[model samples]
Target: MGAAVTPHVVDSHHHVWDLSVRDQEWITGEALAPIRRDFSLTDLLPEARAAGVTATVLVQTVTVAEETPEFLALAADSDLVAGVVGWTDLTRPDAADALARLRQLPGGQHLVGIRHQVQGEPDPQWLLRPDVRRGLAAVGAAGLAYDLVVLPHQLPACVKAAQDHPELTFVLDHVGKPPVASGAIEPWATAVRMLAGLPNTVCKLSGLVTEAAPKTWTVDGLRPYADTVLEAFGPDRLMFGSDWPVCTLVAPYGEVLDVARQLTGSLSDGERAALFAGTATRVYGLRLSEGS
Candidate 1:
C-alpha cells in the first residue's frame, strides 16, 4: 500500500489512432478533437515516459477489418508497445483464417488477443450466437484471447458467452462500464459478479475515470466499482490499464494511475504488483526486457 506499489509500470490498455489515415467515425465532438488530430507512437511515448509507464498494450479503437495489420505494423516500429489486441470479424466463416492472416502481418508476434466492440452491437446475444462462439473457439485454439468491451447491460450475455467457451480467455473492459456517473449499481453489480465467477475471465481496472464527472471524480467515485471488481475477481484475475488519450478526455494518464493506486492501497504488495503490471505481462505474453 505504501505509495501504491510504484514500479516502472506497464499500462495494459491504451490506444493510438489517426483520422487522417481514415476517419475513426467514432470521434464526433469537439471534446474528442485533440485525439482526432493524430495519435501515433510518437505522440504516446513521450507522455508515457513522463508518467513512468515503460510499456503498453496497444488496443483496437476501430472495428474495421483492416486495422489489425495497421496496428501490428505500428508495433514493429516501437519498443513501447509491448503487445497488440487488434480486431477481426468474429462473425465470419473464415474468422479463424482471418486471425491467422493477422498473425502473419509484421509485428504480429506482438498480437496477443482479438477484440470486437461488443458494446456497439445492438443485439445483446450477439456474442452468444453459434457462429460467434465458433470464432471465439478458433481464437482459443490459436492460443489467443478475446476481450469483452461491452456495456453494463450486456453482462448477462457476456457471462453466457464466457461459460460457453471456458477455454477462451475473456477480459472485461472498463469495469463493465457501471453507472457510477449516476450512482446506480443494482443489476450491473449483479451481472458483473456473475461474469467474474467464470474462471477464464478477467477485468481491467481502467476506463472508470471517464465514467464519472471528469473534472470532479474522486477516489470515492471510483471506489465502489473498484472494490467490487477486486472482491469479485481477486488479485490474480484483475489487471491495471491506463485507457490513455481517451483518458485524456477526463484525467491525465498519471492521475488515472494515481486513482488506481489510491483505491487499491489496502492490498498486499504482491497484489498491487499483479494489478499494476504483473498480471498484464502474463495475460498478454508481453515481451519485456530490463529496460521495458
Candidate 2:
C-alpha cells in the first residue's frame, strides 16, 4: 500500500504494554522512559501502516503468568495483531497443564508461540536444564513455538535449546541483540550460523536499531547482521518484524522499515516476499479458510 516496491507485509515481532498494568524492568530511568506509557494496538497500527506492515504478532513483554491471557484477549478483539507469542512458567512442573489452560483463552487461537525472559538469567545454560527442556517439549507437543530473547553472549544457550529440542521451533529475537553500532561481529555471526544450521529454527529481523545508537543508525549499520541472517537462514526461515514502541528509541516505524527494505535490496523478489510476509503466514498458520 505504501508503494509498489513491495506487496503485503506481516511483521513477526512487536510488543504492547502498559506501565499501569506492569513494569518492564528492561527499560530503566534515562534511556527509554518515553515508551513507559501504554503502547497498545491503537498506538501501533498507524506506525505499522506507515511501514506497509498489515499485521503483527504481539509479543509478551513480561514473564508473568497473567500476561499471556491478557495478550490473547487483546488479539481476539483487534485485527492488526495477526497472532501472539505469550509466556508460560517454563520451569514449573505444571507446564503441560499450563499450556492446556492457555488454549482455553478467547485469543488462544492467535497464540502462535510462548516466550520466557531468558535474557535476565546469568546462567546461559538455563534453557537446557531438565525442567526447562520439559517445558519446551510441552510447547512442541501443543504445536506452539518458543522464542529466544537473549544477548549475543547468551547465544550458546540458544544453540543448546534448539539442538536439544529439535521438535520445538525456535525464533531468535533481534538478530541475537548484536552490537551493530560498534561493528562488532565475530562470535555473533558464528553463533548465528551455528543456530541456523538447525532445521527447526527461524530468525526475526526485528529490534536491531535499538541495539545501535538511536537516530544515528544507517542502513549500513544494520546490513551486516541482516545479511548474516538472510545468508544463514535463507528466505524461507527468516521473517520481518518492526519491534515497535521499543523501536521508537531508534527511529520511527516508517524509517525503520525503510532501513530493512534498503538493506534487503540485494535479495531477489521472491526472497524479499518471504521475509516480508510469506514466511509469517505459513509459520503462524495465518492462511484463512473459505469465505464467510
Candidate 3:
C-alpha cells in the first residue's frame, strides 16, 4: 500500500513579538489587554502542528528595522517557518542597499517580502510618496513581494501603487480589513475589487475574526467579506492566514482555521488547496521541501 499524503496547509500571515524587548504600542486599551504579553514561535508550533500547517510565513508586527533580522534568524533556526515578511523603512534612499544587506544576514534567504503599517500612517496616500515609491521599486528589483497591511480607506492608494509597480507582487493582507463589525461592504468591497483587477495583486484571508463584532462574530458574519474577496481575487489569488494571537481576541486558533474552512466550504478541492497552500507558496516563493 502507498503512504497517504498529508495535507499541506500554509499559514500565509501571522506574527510573533517579545514584549520585554519592545512594547507593541498598538496593543493599548482594555480590549487588547489579552495579547499584551510576549508571543513566540515556540508558542505557535503546537497549535500550528495541530492545525496541520506544514509551513508558515511569519509577518512583521512593527516597523523596526532590527525586527527583520531577528525574524530572519528565527526562520533560519525553525523548520516550520519557511518565509518571513519583514519590515524595512521604505522611505530610506538606500532601501535597495538595505534589502541587499538583509539578504546577506544569517537567515536572510528566508525573507520573502517587506511590509509597512500603512493602516497606522496618518496620510492615506503614504504609499504614493516619492521616497516610498523609490523603496517599492527597490523591493521589486530585489524580486521580493510587498505586503500591504492597510485599512479600507488606503486601498485606493494601494491600487495606484500596484499600477505604478507592475513588476512587484502586492499582497493585500486581511482583505483590506472590511468593516465586518458594522456589516458595511460598499467602499471596501469596491476598492478591493479594484485592487484585485491588477494582475500583480493577491489577498490574504486573515484578520476578519478580529475585525468582526468582538466575540459574538459568526461564520455567517464573515461570509460576506470572504465571498467578496473569493469572487474578486478568486481562490488562486487568495491565501489563508490565522492572524494568530490577535485572532485569539475573538476565537481560538482552531476555531479561526475552522471558520476559514467554513467560509471557503463552497470551493472545489483544488480551489481550497490553492487558498490553503498553493497561493502562498507561489506568491512567497517559499522554499518548502517534501519533508516540510
- Candidate 2: tens digits of C-alpha lDDT, residues 128-220: 889999999999988888899998888988898898888889999888999887889888999999999999999998888889877587777
Candidate 3, run of 10 with poorest lDDT? 1-10
lDDT value for model 2: 0.84
Candidate that beats the other on lDDT, 1 or 2, i.e. the better one = 1
Candidate 3 to truth, TM:
0.97
Per-residue CA lDDT of candidate 3, range 1-292, in tens? 1212227789999899998888899999999999999999999999998888989999999988899999999999998999999988989899999999999999999999999999999999999999999999999999999999999999999999999999999999999999999989989999999999999999999999999999578788888999999999999999999999899999989788888888888887899889999999999999996866
User: Which candidate model has the greater TM-score, 1 or 3?
Assistant: 3
| Winner on TM-score (1 vs 2) | 1
Q: Using Cα atoms with residue i matched to residue i, what is each candidate's TM-score against the true structure? A: 0.96, 0.95, 0.97
Evaluated with lDDT, which candidate comes out highest?
Answer: 3
lDDT of 1 at 106: 90
What is the Cα-based lDDT of residue 25 in candidate 1? 86
Per-residue lDDT over 1-292 for candidate 1, one digit per residue giving the tens place of the 0 to 100 score: 3456567788989988777778888888876776666777887888889878888999999888778898888888888988999898878999889988888889889899999989989999889888998899999988887888999889999999888898988989888989887878878999999999989999999999878876677788789999999999998889989898898888887788888888899998889888888888888888987896
